[model samples]
Target: GAGIKSLFGGEITQYVTMMEESRDEALQRAIEHAKDLGANGIIAIRFDSNEISDVMQEILVYGTAVVVEKE
Candidate 1:
């Protein structure tokens, strides 16, 4: 993905900021979904992104939700 400079003046770039926010939101949603399905944990987590347009992008976070048993 292409990088963008911060409009407000900062060390962190816009692209990095966007990705961080997106990742946090996606992970939160994934965890909530897993909980709804009665999953104890999420495994094999992965993140993927695609450029939808010049100034737009899509982020996807996926993982397997599994139940664990303690012996």
Candidate 2:
């Protein structure tokens, strides 16, 4: 299994828009990373969240991306 790493902007408490955008940004980064690594697909995706400050948080997205050989 291959791995890719991605990180997005920190989250903000009570800011739904920012939080949502951060999550999306993280996912997009992960996908781009996989693409750059020549992965044909990504699976078993997961996300992690951490508190960055009293009103801020961080979002992490990761998954297994594999390269496939076409016959």
Candidate 3:
């Protein structure tokens, strides 16, 4: 599919959608984990992506969890 599409060389929307979904999933999981740790907020968030293979990809997110209090 991609091999043929690459000949034209334009935006690959399918891959865009897939990667967006992956990034959202990774971010949501990170938020859930921070919640589990009783964190009221997160700081210094960052994301990274990698290609394990032609078809396989990885999306990861990490941050510092912090408890915020109203003064």
Candidate 2 residue spans exceeding 4 A from truth: 1-14, 68-71
lDDT ranking from best to worst? Answer: 1, 3, 2
Q: In candidate 2, what are the lDDT values of residues 52-71, reduced to their tens digit?
A: 89978999998998887879
Name the candidate that leads on lDDT: 1
Q: Where does the lowest 10-residue lDDT sum fall in candidate 1? A: 1-10
Cα lDDT of candidate 3 equals: 0.84
Residue pairs clashing, model 1: none
Task: Report lDDT (Cα) of residue 4, candidate 3.
Answer: 21
| Tens-digit lDDT track of model 3 for 1-71 | 22324458876778877878888899889889999999988999999988899889899898999999999
Query: Which stretches of candidate 1 lie above 4 Å from their native place?
Result: 1-12
The 10-residue segment of model 3 with minimum total lDDT is 1-10
Sort all candidates by TM-score, best to worst.
Answer: 3, 1, 2
Candidates 1 and 3 compared by lDDT, better number = 1
The alpha-carbon deviation from the true structure for residue 14 of candidate 3, after best TM-score superposition, in angstroms, is 0.6
For each candidate in the order shown, give its overall lDDT on alpha carbons.
0.86, 0.79, 0.84
TM-score of each: 0.79, 0.69, 0.85
> What would the per-residue lDDT of candidate 1 be over residues 6-68, giving only the tens digit for each residue?
667554565687788998899999999999999989999999999999988888998999999
lDDT of 1: 0.86
lDDT of 3 at 8: 82
Error of 1 at 1 (Å): 14
